[model samples]
Target: MTANVNIAIKHTSLLISGALLGLLHAGLANASGYPVTVQSCDRQVTFDHAPKAAVSNDVNLTEMMLALGLQDHMAGFTGVSGWKTLDPTLRNGIGELKELSPKYPSKEVLLGADADFYFAGWNYGMRVGGGVTPDTLAPLGIKVYELTESCIHIMDKPKVSMDDLYIDLLNLGRIFDKEEQAQSLVKGYQEDLTNFQANLTPLKTIPKVFVYDSGEEQPFTSGRYGMPTALIEAAGGKNIVDDVQKSWTQIGWEAVIDRAPEFIIIVNYGDVTAEQKINFLRSNPAFKNIPAVKNNHFVILEYIEATPGPRNINAIKRLAEAFRTAL
Candidate 1:
C-alpha cells in the first residue's frame, strides 16, 4: 500500500482503539453529556468528545475557534486571508497557529493533517462536490461542524437572524466543552446589541442603505436573508434591496438608482477595496444624482464584520454611529 493509505489505515486503527476505550469509559463520556449530536444543513453529526486535533476553515470559522481560545485544539487552518484585516488581538491568536493552506485544501491534504474535527460550513471549507466533503470525511473519523450563517444558503432555513451567531458559538462551546465560555460570549454580544438598539430610540430618520458587495456592471448586494439586513435594521437603517430574499445577489445599477439610497455600505473583501467601490460610485455619471454618492455618505465594513460572527456587534456599533452622524 502507498504511504497515504498506510497513514489512513493506521489512523483508522487508532480511531477504533480510541472509540473502544471511549465505550469502556462510558461513564466518563456521560459525565460531560457527550456523544452530543448537532444538526447542520439537514444532517446530524455526533461528537463523542472534544476534538483533540481540529482544523478551522474560512475566516468566520477561524475567528470563532480563536474567540473561544481553542487554538490548542486546532491542528491547523485554511481558507481566507482575513488575518491582515483582523483586529490586533484576534490576529495575534491566529498568528500562532499553522496555516495548512491559503485556500481550501483537497481531501488528501486534509487527511494528511490527521484532523479529527473540521470547523467549517457549506461552500466555505467543503463545497458541494469537493473531495473533502463532510460525508466523505465521516468514514475517516472526522466530524464537520457547519457555521449557522452559511446554513441559510445550504439548507431550507426560514431567514437569517442574530441568533444564528449565538447558536454557532454555543454549539462550538459544546463541542469544545466550553459551554460556560460560549454563554458568556453570547451574553456579551446580546448586551452590546441591546445597547445599540436602545441608542436608536432618539433617531427619527432611518437612511435608505445600499450594500455594495462588488461588480461594475451590476452591484452584488445583500438581500433580506443575509446578516447585513439584520445589521442594517439594528443600526437604524433600511436595506433598499430587502426584497431580494437571497443572502447575497446581483441587482442592476438602474434598480439601485431608482431606490436612491442615502447611505452606501461597502463590503470589504476579495480583490476589491472599499476605496475602489467608493471611487466607482463617485466617478460614474449615473451615480451623480444618488444621495449617497453625491454626499459621499459611505460606510466601509470589513467582510468579516458583515458575516455572522463575533465581529457583527462591532459592525452594528460602527454602522449605528455612522448613521447618527450622516443623518
Candidate 2:
C-alpha cells in the first residue's frame, strides 16, 4: 500500500471511543443485531449469528474484511497470489491466514476449507452461470455477500459511484456484526473525500482520460459502469469510454484514436509491468499523435486502488494531483 492509504482504521479521531469501543469485540456481537438480514444484490440474505468461519476472495474484498478487523472471523482468503503480489501492508494483515487457492476456487476447494461464509462477487471469484455463485453455494450451507460493484455482470444496475464502495462496507459490517467499525470507516472516507474535493484546485476543464487495464490487440478497461469511472470523475477527469453501457470490456484501438484522450490511467497488475505498458503506448507508431502519448501524461493506479478497496480514497488523491500536474 502507498503511504497515503491506510489499510486499517488509522484515523483514531474518526472512530468511536469510551464504552462504544467495547462493541468492536466478539463479546458484543449481538449488539449490532442477530438474525439480521441485509440486501445482497438481488436477494435478502439473513445471518442468524455473526459468521464464525468466513472466506473472502480477491485482494479488494479481502482488504475490506481485514479493514473491519474481521481476520479473526476468517478461516482463510483466496484469489490473490495468482495475479497480484501482496504488498507489505497486505502481508501484515493476510500473511497469517491460509490462502485456500491462488485464483478462483472450485466448489471442492471452497468446500474443503469448511467456510461458512463466502465474501465474493461476480467474476471476482464466482462467475455468472459458473460453478460458484450464491445459488450453487446455498445448498452447501455457505452464505455469500456479492460485491456491489460486481453486480453489473448479472443485472442492469446503477452507474458506478463511490456509494457502491460504501454500500459494500456498510453491508459487510451488518453481516459480520461490526457496525461501529464499518460506520467509522465509512464516515471517515466520506468526510475525507468531501474535504479533499472541496480543497482541490479548480480545473479549467475536465481532461478526457483512458484506462489501460491490460490488452494489446484490444484494450480492456472500465466503461460507464466500472469502478474507475467513478474514480476518474472523483479525480476531476472523465473516462473516455464512459459512454459504453458495459462495465469492464474490450474496445477497438480505432475507438481510442477517435476519442483521443489527453491523459491515461494505467491499471498496473497481471503479467505485464506498468513500465512495459507505457513503452507500448510510447513506441507504437499508431499512437504517435495522441495527446497523452505525446505529452507523456499518465498515472499508474494499482489494481487494488483502481478496483473497490480502502486504497480508493488515496487513489483519487493521487489522480487529482497527477491531473493537476499534467495540466
Taking all chains together, each candidate's TM-score versus the true structure is 0.85, 0.90
lDDT of candidate 2 over 220-286, digit per residue (tens) = 9889988898888877778999999977899999989889999999999889999999999999999
The residue-by-residue lDDT of candidate 1 on 1-327, one tens digit each, is: 233333432332222233223322432344466777665667777787899989988777789888898988988888865333445666687876777877887777677889999878766777777688778998998888887767766666755667667777777777777776876787777776775555353455557899998999988899878889878776767789988877877889999999999999998877778899899999999999999999989999987789877899889889878877877
Model 1 regions lying over 4 Å from their true place = 1-31, 82-87
lDDT of 1: 0.76
Candidate that would win on lDDT: 2
Tell how far residue 58 is off in model 1, in angstroms: 1.8
- The pairs that clash in candidate 1 are none
